[model samples]
Target: MNKAITEGLLLMPPAFSNGLDQWSSQDGTVGSDTYDGAVNAAFVAADQDFGGCLELLKSETTQKLRAMVQTPLHPGCYLQIKARVKAISGNLPNVEIAGWAGGAGDVHVLDVVEAGPSVALTSYGEVVEVSAIVGTGARNGVDMPWGQDALYGHFGLNLTGANGGVVRIDDIQITDVTNVFLRDMMDWVDVRDYGAIGDGVTDNAAAFNAADAAANGRQVLVPEGVYALASNVTFESPVRFQGQVTAPKEVRLSLTKNFDFGSYVDAFGGDEVLALEKAIQALFNFTDHESLDLQGRRIELTRPIDVQDVVNNISTYAIRRVIRNGQFNVLADPAWDTDVVTSTASYSASTSTELTNVANIANIQPGSLVEGNGVGREVYVKSVNVGAQTLTLSQPLFGAASNQSYTFSRFKYALDFSGFSGLDKFVLDDIEFQCNGISSGILLAPEGLIFHVRDCFITKPKDRGITSHGRGCQGMLVDRCQFISNEQPMRAQDRTTIAMNVNANDTKMRDNRVMLFAAFGVWAGTGHLFSGNHWFHGDGETDGVRRAGVIFTTPNPKSTVVGNYIDNNFIEMTNEHDATPDWNNQYSFGGITITGNIFTVNDVAPWFSWIVVKPYGSGHYLHGFNLSGNVFRALNGNIERIERVDETYAGLDMSKSRNVVVQGNAFNSVDTPIFNPLMVRHTEAANATTWEIPTDGKLPFGGRARRVEGFVMDQQVLRGSNTAHYEFPYVSLQQGADQSEAHLKWSQACRGRVQITLRMDNAT
Candidate 1:
């Protein structure tokens, strides 16, 4: 079940129904400005209690009004401060909600500001909410003033520079948003509070386990230290573990256990018993019934017996068998043959590719490629008319078809469920989980909900860093994290054993940094948003690692991937062998939006392009893609920015791929930009529609012989000397229309003396 963790209200007598007994106010005057406030009737009647509200008035000067409420606060928790304010006249006042912490000779203050003019305040006033995390790094000062200690603080609202205006404050509130699981459970049982040493050498796993069991559902605090675990630590119930509030509470949980998880084995009968035996022998090197335990009975096999003998023996004994960690391989069974139907009637060569059959046509599905032996052709099935006993192909047959035999093959995969399972409503924050040479860092099995992993560092895993598989694994958010040196930073694989089955959905990956990810950085399912994340491949070694930034493997309906604000992200090629950077499946069915991303290609390798769209099945189209406002910087000038690959090739059928907009992209290259052949194919056209070739050895009337559709190069600024002869259209068109090619032709005397600047404005 899904759970919404509510915040705890921290304001005492929040409404200000009484007087300002619980609040302290300070007024400062500068440049003939006066501040005035009391329980007044300036606020709206509905918001005021007892027909009165706290009002602060300023008159024609720089006046400051500070109203603060001192309260005990926990560090590292997010505090949401809200209030209702009005600007009676003149400029709107600047509002600041700040947290002040003082202990061990240090005073730290963090502020969240809602500047005056931006806050919409009129006679009716408006409610504004400002959120800030309370921690040492969030301190407002310029530098660290004193030594660090346990944080204790108060929250306050400061209204400053209200020139010639009266701003009233009412209905103020502060909330504790640290532990979403149990916000009201303030009675925390710390591991150190319950006889636990946080030294690096001591085993604190038992102490943490004890404190978790005894604290019920309260918060369990693990202070800033290195807590080592000699074995795996398991939590049986819901618990909240909070760390120090100062920095990212440096609680390192060192685990030293070999990973092991349960695996599922299917029931075998008939000829399947031999398949299972072969699979077991291949996976675990096991042979013969002497080493096997079936149905709690030890059966001796004297000779090479058929699978029917084992099935009869188990049926006679009235026993059931359970296999653990046993592999199961399923090949094509001769009993379930692929040759289901044959053509009953035949006809001569016709205009259409429809064939009549006497057998049931319900088995024929769309997208299935069927081959006709008589016609010597293979066509993709478009539709099957079950009532008419006819099947239509996407293309016409080459020749006439007689009675031809047809067969269909379906792909299958082995069942591999070797991962952890059964974790729910757990939050892993403010901790560093290092998997030293292990395959998986954390793998959630079939179903879980509301799993939040934020503000953590995961590094050095052999395989995936974090993965959530299975159905009902909804609302899993991985935010503000760092993953370093892993095979796949994060992935969401299929829940079942099928090859193309997808179950993970509604997962969000935001504001994470991945460095040196060997394979795909993120492989997510449908309805997943990947935003504000940065990925970098290996430092400088070009040893051919399959480095894709983000890949959407599952068939999602609609998704969005937005990048970081700056230009620090480097989307390297998919290793040195295949230089394609990223891949998106067209079968996702969902419209994908890729915007505001920056691709940095610094290496001097043969880079294919930024992204390639590969469809799952034949005739599948990539629809409704909006790729705009991205920057491509190629320092080595060997990269094709964007190439559309349909059916495993670098070509796109514009009729099938509909509603694609590629605009507002900037490309910076040290040398001539390498445009993909698919993008500049029109430049090689033999005929010109609007312009004529020149007779005299000069340039053509409109420069090139072809016009490129859906791409516009608006302006070209050429520099240097030596009379460079550039042949291109010196004209302008609509923003997103076809563009003419700019061909630079100069003698060897002007080789390195000229520079060209071309601007790509629109693409469709």
Candidate 2:
């Protein structure tokens, strides 16, 4: 494609005579410019003309007509102009497109190009096409910063060539040639071309591999069919895998088994015991292990596992033993060995992790992993007893189980593809990736760039749906995707474990839907944009910790999560983690923008809060935060709309937070608008004397002295409910004066339900 086909922006066949709304005559001498059928008849024979041509009758004076195109043309884009011209008397008028920078009256021309003549003109008219490559340079003796300045183009016709000259111009068009070429270029290879069948039973791994290899740098196409994949496929170069289906659920890449995990196993050695331990550790990353009594004998396997193991199902005690050849083994004990257990028990949808069975529960123990064969669910045993047959899980099960076959075993990650390098610009589109009890669905290498995963469905990953690690992985975009039934749907943590370490930069997650996520909907990093996303029923299970709608956790010394924008999202029914609340760890020196979001907490709980800005360490403090244009609805319990507390301080102390603006927020059924608490001590006062308040408005502290500043809460509207009354003077503050003994009380009580429009200045 040429530059004009890619960069030109004019619409095709721009009919002008129908209505001259965007067109204006430069000279009144051009008259009788009606959009009637007579005007259009003059250019009927032109190839580019459809109908409704602009007919101009020129008088004795010089006649000129120009129409402005409001579209902003980009620099480096080629412009293609086409028009049908019919000249009736005297010389034919010339046509040209001119671009102007700044505004009208600036008289600064950025570009000017004349239309070229066509072949032979008939009695009707002739079609002419002109081209101009826009550049950033002087045009018409005026400096043209093509893209830098506000620019518009004009299509002008000079009818001064002949007196009483009648000219008919139709099918005027302008096109962006450069963009058209890049968007419509079809350089691809179909996977079916590589002798593969989409019968949903054939293993098409080789077919995809071959197509990707043949694709070189072009896209690999997968047609609308169910393609079965038995193994993982590697994309070694910059290539896209496009499918013919509209949604990812249409063209499925069904995996019969979990992704391979053998790569994570350590090599076997002569030291059998140590090798076995390393193999187990490599597979599960178990924090602690011990021996447990089975019947009367001490079982030779790991036991009493760490919370991480149970919460993430990293490993199960039933299959805790690793053999000498680096293979896992599940031991059988007579005390717990019984027929395969089946349950007619039913469970309701709840955020609780406890399950009741009431029978045949003597064998189950803590740290044991159980799988629901009928319901396709798994859980790590937190507690069990023969008396109640109650099994508490580390995380809540989103769905109910009934008439399900329960199998006991250790949970190991089915998929493991990590530590690979040189995989860049890989695209996975229009495919459904099933994890089948794996830790992650897709794990990128530490070194890769421009990885795009769009229009995809990923489900049932034990840990995360999709993730990447280290600073080397950047420029990843995940758009129009759905992530369901995962612990953490999308995570890009910084330098943690394989499950938590994702330090990728310039990553974006847009137009995605995440549901039934047991943890944070998205745990992202610096330069990340989470926009137009819907997250529901999230943070259901925190494993006794804090959860959030979206957590931006960067390390200390980095004052802010740089260049992050979270906007236009709807989040509902997300439970907070034990200590951390929603939108956690937002301490970026570069500032954060949280706007146009609607947060609803229907299930009331005491730990729920809209936001918490606290210092994790001495150097870790929020530099700038802008919380505006957000709506909080149906919030229950003693939840703070926005709280600022430094865990490092026990009393009124110096807070490192600065440049925080909270405005244009609406709260409904909220307990407190803002909560800033300080603990203070008192001492005996000396002889009484008249004391005036400090000019600086800082409360004088004597015991455990520390300085504190007030925060501003403005432009907030709070609506009261009958169930919970809203109280006034929502700003709670504590100030100590003269080392005198006095007690300050901050109460949370409602006298009556009433609507209040409130504002607080210098509220500490």
Candidate 3:
């Protein structure tokens, strides 16, 4: 047996000494090899109590130290990362030994060595295998760029929020030594320095050009400072360009121009023609070097001649030709406010007028009244100058706060990244993006790619915030994240996770918090898992009511939604103007296993309450769902009538979906017990091909279509495995008329350790 020892640390196996030569004592700041490995000078008492018995007091200068190990790693190698951590202070933070793969940019965070309440100073440290970062088995595999100056990278010891504590490590080795070669390796490139050109002073266009030029499948590190952008920046590669480090008080990143239309759509005649031609060329068939006739193809115009006509013609793409009206002479003639009459009371005609000497107070005016072709209604305008408008104005006129705190004007997306590809693993960590007042702040489409987002906060999403669609991407994990939206928190397009056109499998959404949105929070696609999330959708007078704390949609076959807490939602919608009418739409699934969750819906929005398990798109193949061991408290919705089921389509909608199992679930303070908990599918009304539910009809008997088959209905089904103390005495048949095959059996008196045996056999 070999024993290796350092100054204040001891370990078995001499291999630790070689691996730890790169680390020096904590006398001074650790060199670049160790980022900041200085033992806290303030930790005088703590360090002295290492092997001593002085009853060490927790020091005030608690700074966790991090170091990098100098080891050579190659392909096909298996490494066991072991760390012996002892927390001698109050609630010591978990000590982690992380492996940083150079090529693939992978950081495998190993098991946590924590000093729990049970973890004492004696027998405090133990060696455990966190995980294996195995290299590829291919012969021409990659070798970790070790020993080389540039190719080599450093692993960081993130003392995240670990104030004034000490942790020790030993037996850290890369074992199972099969070498993964360089050929089969995934190369990782991180933009270490995002060269900022303009300091919001000189010129920012160079910074954008340099960033766009250097934005590859790496990180574009933007130093914490003001980068004044004169023009729109286009990032055609997978890169992250960070702004200020300490989060700018006003706007960390400010584009010189208020709005850049050329950034999103090419208004230039040449580039637009080229893009159009490329698209048209793909559709046409050329044969024998002879060009086909591409004439007589006409494009329709859509923008209405005026503002009132805006909603009328949508399919049309005609741009509104604005002729500026005369400027208001506020100093000479204050004739606009009291007697607001002009060439045309319509804002449409006002756009055509030019205002030379008049100050464009369009920015500061509270609201404007414009005339429509028919009768003029009070249409509020949020923007003064068409280009630049305060982000606070994005809020609805009725919901505007009394004391407005101005931040920044609503700017276009900082970077238009639709053209960039191979960026599935794009990382935007440790940064802040303020819409300052923008819309849909950071729109991302990892679009059929694998990505990792950690330690990031995307706030002030004006509209449907942070919309992402992973059509066929897998292993997308969003960890330690936050999103604050005024509207819907997150919206995912159809078939985002499952194998629609691509396979979106094994997606993990964990450790996230969302606050106060208009609609659903964290809405994901089919065949995904949601765990360990704290969501709060506040129901106040200002915010419009939304759907669920976390809603999963579009018919997922097999998925698990567990360990989530949703409080104060759905039932809080009021009957007032634009209020979220229903609140308790919680934990509804067609073919899912919902376990270990809590939902609380009290007063405020009552008309819509209760967890609904309704089907989508005519309720087809909604089978094999399990609801077990969850708690629902303070739920109050209409006991008699569940809200509109087939409101989108005319059909005999299914009240209960097929093959659902509800077992070992408890409900408290619940007025309207679950009626048709499993909403089934039925035939649509004639002449209805889409989800257009008819309003006039009696809405069919028992709410919607249902199936009373080999399963438990109204009451909770008991599956004999769980250990929770639950009793279902009177199982009532909610909507079934005759003695159907599926019937509820009520036990006369269920006692203390009584469990129900519900076996769902598919016997026709």
For candidate 1, the per-residue lDDT at 337 reads: 26
| lDDT of candidate 3 over 384-485, digit per residue (tens) | 443442211111121212222222122123222222222344443443334322333333333435545555555554333343322313456666677665
Sorting all predicted structures by TM-score, with the top scorer first, yields: 3, 1, 2
Weakest lDDT window of 10 consecutive positions for candidate 2:
258-267
Every model's Cα RMSD, please?
A: 32.7, 31.5, 31.6
Better of 2 and 3 by TM-score: 3
Estimate TM-scores for all models.
Answer: 0.34, 0.33, 0.34
> Which sections of candidate 1 miss by over 4 Å?
1-424, 486-503, 520-524, 542-546, 555-557, 565-590, 646-651, 670-689, 692-764
Cα-based lDDT for every prediction: 0.40, 0.40, 0.33
Error of model 3, residue 188, in angstroms: 30
- Show where candidate 2 strays beyond 4 Å: 1-419, 486-501, 521-525, 538-546, 555-590, 635-640, 644-654, 675-764
Q: Roughly what TM-score does model 1 have, to 2 decimal places?
A: 0.34
Model 1 over residues 355-390: C-alpha lDDT tens digits?
A: 676354676644343555433212334456789877
